[model samples]
Target: MSKTPSLARRTKSFQASPTAALDAAAKRLAAEGHTVCNLASGEPDMEPVAAIREAAAKAAMGGYSKYTQVSGTLSLRQAVSRALLRDQGLSYQPDQIVVSAGAKQALFNAFSCLLDPDDEAILPAPYWVSYPEQIKLAGGRPVIVPADAAGGYKLTPEALSQALSPKSRLLVLNSPNNPSGAVYTDSELSALVEVALDHGLTIVSDEVYQQVLYPPARHVSPASLSAAAFSATVLISGVSKTYAMTGWRIGYLASPDPDLIRAAAALQSQTSGNPTAVAQRAAEVAWDLPPEATRHQLAAFTARRRLVLDALAEVTGTELVPPNGAFYGFLSIAGCLRRWREEAADAFCERLLAEDKVAVVPGSAFGAPDAIRFSFAVADDVLKEALVRLTQALRR
Candidate 1:
């Protein structure tokens, strides 16, 4: 037999998403008649609003199902343009937008285009799991700067400044952050943007959770800081979170730098091509819907947040920095890990799932080995039961 060819060198940098892995394990157990309470999913449990669904149906029936422009349909791109202006007061023309399969792909395209081999991309700790992986796959090095509970799990300007090197070329920011739900205030972003600008860094701001915010907390786009900041940013967002349309697979990147937009679009064109045709049309309806349309979903998340908060409070030895925007609770389980005689969060999480039947993503997935992340975007009863089971398991 002939020898098998070796996999590409980049394959070494790939790791499957931890949340998806846990979800698969939970589903396998459930199929075997286990009573599993899964809180590992990051997507909303609700369906897209009626208006958005109606548009998809209309598109499918009206034969709007063909492939769109490589970038996106002009109509959808215009909707994205209007949305950016309306929400962030940052203006971007259609040519400056590249709609991709998801914000993940958009981020990947940005990294692929911006990074040369061995370039450094700054990522704050407790970040979304995919950021570092994506950067590495792009032939860039990820420089992780740890942020603690004392800093509200957010990167500070001083830390960012210290992490910079001549090799530094990109900075990734996720507001209403995943796994942490830490939203940066405008002043905070401005201070960070100032640091990034001083170093001539290209800022990739992921704002997918922009509309999933709670009151007294607001989403601020770094690009909205000023013209200089706008020019330095590659803004990534999607209708997935706000519209309960994760499967729709629609996300986009917008930048005032035409060169960056063109490069990302070209990269996307050769990869996934345009996103689904009908999803683009439906996302137009989603993007155009007034803020009032999704208020009910946000209301549900708020109620669930309270439920998770109360439930977690009863779980001894766990600490949570209450989320202000996204529908996740990142719990520090160091105390619980020590009590359970487990040295890592992943090991504790595995036992929690196997023995207790509650699923969560280990904190190690997000560069924080002593913590774990659970989504509260599930049903009220499901969340309640899962928390109860978690508390009981921790006690033992």
Candidate 2:
């Protein structure tokens, strides 16, 4: 038999996202009737807003199923621009917005459009699982800055200053971050923006969870903080988290720079070629709806956060940090290390799944070892059950 054709080097460089792996494992256990409680997935269990669904139905009935322009429909782009102006206090024209399948694709499009071979991108530790992989896929180097747990898993200006170099093309910032749920304050964001401007680095701010902050905690967008930051910032956001429209597949990128938006749109044309036309129409409504629905969700999430935190509090040696926003509790399980021969985060997660029937994504996947991420987007009873199981597993 002839040797198999060599696969592309790019294919070899890519690794499956850890969130996907943990979700798959949970599904397998549930299929085997283990009564598994999956705290692994990042998606919210709530349904999309009724207005969005109705709009989608109307769009489909009205023959809005055709492919849209590469950058998205003009109306949706206009809606996105208005949203930026209204919410973030940033201004952009329709041409400066490109709607993509999800915030993930929007980010990938930015990397593809901006990165060249050997270019460098900075990611804070405990970042979203996809950032480093995306940088590598774009033929760029990922320079990860480790954020100490002592700092409550937050990145600092000193760390950013040390990581910057001439080749630094972008710095990916996810506030109200996934996995960790650590939201940066206005001052923290401003400080980092100052560092980025000093180094001539483009800032890619992922604000997907901007509206999920708890009481006394406010989200501050880097682009909204200063004109210098806005000039170099590409703000990425979507209705997936805020409006509970994850399956709707509508997300957008807004930039003040027309050239960068155009470059991302060019790649979108050849790749996904705009998001679903109907989804885009529904998202237009989502962006325009009253704030009641989102505010309700945030309140419910905050209550759930309290429940989970209280339950986990009784367990000894488990260091759980209360998230300021986003629906995740990232626990420092380094104390649980003594229970296992191997102290690696992934190994601990595997044991918990096997022993407790509770599934969670390990923090090593986010470049932070000795921790695990517990998503609290499930129902209250489900979250309680998962926490109970986790408590039992950890105590043993």
Task: Show where candidate 1 strays beyond 4 Å.
Answer: 1-6
Residue 220 of model 2 has an lDDT of 88
Worst 10 residues of 1 by lDDT: 308-317
List TM-scores for all candidates, in order: 0.97, 0.96
lDDT tens readout by residue for model 1, 171-196: 99999999898999988999999999
Q: What is the C-alpha lDDT profile of model 2 across 43-72, one tens digit per residue?
A: 888887788899999999999988888888
lDDT of 2 at 40: 94
lDDT of 1: 0.91
Each candidate: what lDDT? 0.91, 0.87
Pairs of colliding residues, candidate 1:
none
